[model samples]
Target: MRAYNETWIENKNVVSQAERWHRRSLLTDDQLTAVRKAYPVGFQTMNGFLEIGLFIFTIIATGGVFLLFVELLSIDDSSIFGLYCLLFGIGLAILNNVLIRRRQFYRNGVDNALVMATTALMVGGFNSQFLDDGSLWQWCLVALPLLAAVVWYYGDTLITFIALAVLYTCLFDLTLEASFGRTLLPFVGMVVSGLLMQATRMIRQRAYYDDAVSLTQWVALAMLLVSVNYYVVRETNWLLIRSTLRRSGVMSPPEIDLPWLFWLLTVGLPIGYLWQGFVRKNRMLIILGVLGVAAAVATIRYYVGILPLNVHLTLCGLFLIGIAVGGIRYLRSSRYGFTDVPDEDSPDEFLISSDVITAAQVAAGTSGHDQHDNVKFGGGKFGGGGAGGGYN
Candidate 1:
């Protein structure tokens, strides 16, 4: 179901781990080189900045070509235009496949851009042709499957996010028509996000889906917090109520039902997240928990106005700094597998090294070179250099 070689993906993981070990002084330079040779990742990738630039260029080029083709053919009819879009989208999808299989383009900008363009054109074409008068949920329904298929094939994190958004839209839209839709909406979101988090946790051990699953877990955690957030629930409910009231010629300030419940959820959810995060030692949860607390504070200040804005912000900043200082001091000696010091075994070390090396290479004007060249730090074989050899 995947486009890239599974072995290559596994090898990429091995190389990343090896790179981390080498940075930690666990593996010598020669051993790192041997590891890279043993587990070669043949995917053609680019530096982060270059990837973004190329991605933008590919999108512009593809869109320009499509427009030029349409103009040259004088195709103006809506249905005809839709057909052309579908055709172009299919062509781009094929091109994407060719790039991945034949050219060995992995998450490089060109492939990423092609995949994105293909999804957009396909959805837009379908909408223009058959769903012109359809509701937004219908459009979302059309996109959900397409996005899921793309995720299955490419395992792209951005595409996964888009798919999750579409899925949530469809879920919420469908629920909105139920007898007590608005009241059930938040609970529904929470339940779905929780289930998704659980599923991702179960499957995240798989190397092929690791990145996608990890991102999904983070998103799910955030959604779980947002599902019952006071500000979101109040604003969204009021918007719905305002529309209904205006339709019925009733103009009054809309009030939310079960305000106390939302308030409790807003205050309690973050604490719960923080507790679970620490107990489980999950970094995503901890980060989201901190963010959730900040959001809750802002929500409270927006309504309560206990202190001046500047004063509140200053207090919050100082409080956070104090916590940071205290935590660092407390964790200096390590506690329950947690520490303030950097962990050499952490994957972040390898990522940081990769970024630094890529930046250095770019600054040195040595970004372009043959893959067969023996560069430093396992270059041309692993650790950000172009990996050679055919995909199995």
Candidate 2:
């Protein structure tokens, strides 16, 4: 009985020692390192490349715009044909698209392509040459609507805005050039295009507000301002007004000019951009503000140039006053434009609060603020205090 009890105690001691050794082996340096290395990581996404590629494309597009302008300026009275140039530009646009696709990932290729294509179409308009007897300007009246149609089909606001710009330019040419008939086509076309752009934006329900809308509105506003200045200058002198307005169509039974149509560009147009930037939180709204101020200054400068120093200063002061008041109003009402991302599981929708303005945000500026500081905006919020990922 004593020998049996001693044997059982010895067996128990052996089992305990083996278990201790096994645990110690698992805690060894080699085993610890292997376990650390086994954690799963997800880092194969190409988002970095996508961003870099987009920047490159933007630069290329800018260069292309410069080239188009240079070609337009080179045209002379003797040389009438610009169709060749337009065709050449279209070809280059196509080739550029192909190269961009090959060099970059296909994330937003369609969007990029549509923008380039729209640019090509507008450049084509600039190259138009009228071949009628003694008339060197070709009719570009047809291209505006066609281009807008394409933009609408693609559901691309950037390109649609370009189409709108082209239409607005056409309207300017019509009113200033005296081709009132020509203006009708683009006027109706742009109103329709603008509606289409608004509709697409609504239907698609974009997750974020686009800055391009602001830019386009600025372009339109500038055009309207220039037209206004031209009209005001013409009103003071009938002969000059007659020459400027005679380019398109005759009014009042082929003699009297219709002046009311001219104010539509100035009085009604800037309001669009004002709404976008001040109310919609569009960054492009800043552009509208700049252009609006410039237009006002240019108009005042035209009138001020003929006046004495005191009058000029007073005119300038008045202009500044109007601008300041508008700026204050716009700033006070503007919403912080930011994208709100919601969690997949949570019922609560997360949005960027207006209080957490960053340097980037200050730089972007919400409304009525100078573009000196950076104010960061647009990001999702969460319950956790720290950010997490699938892997460290």
Q: Which one wins on TM-score? A: 1
Per-residue error for 145 in candidate 2, Å, reads: 6.3
In model 1, the runs with Cα more than 4 Å from the true position are 244-253, 344-352, 355-392
Local error of candidate 2 at residue 73 (angstroms): 28
What tens digits encode model 1's per-residue C-alpha lDDT throughout 57-123? 9999998999999999999899999999989999999988888888778778889999899988988
* 1-392: candidate 2 lDDT, tens digit per residue: 11012222233233323323433473564543333234211111123245457646765775586567657766544333355455544655565555534543222343355356545644554445433332222234555655654544333445655566666555545554564543343344445446545654555332122233433443443433443433332443344345645665543122224434544444444455566666765554444444544454444344335776677667767987997787566656443643233221112211232222222223322111111111111111110101111010
Worst 10 residues of 2 by lDDT: 383-392
Candidate 2 residue-pair clash tally: 26
175, model 2: CA deviation in Å? 7.0
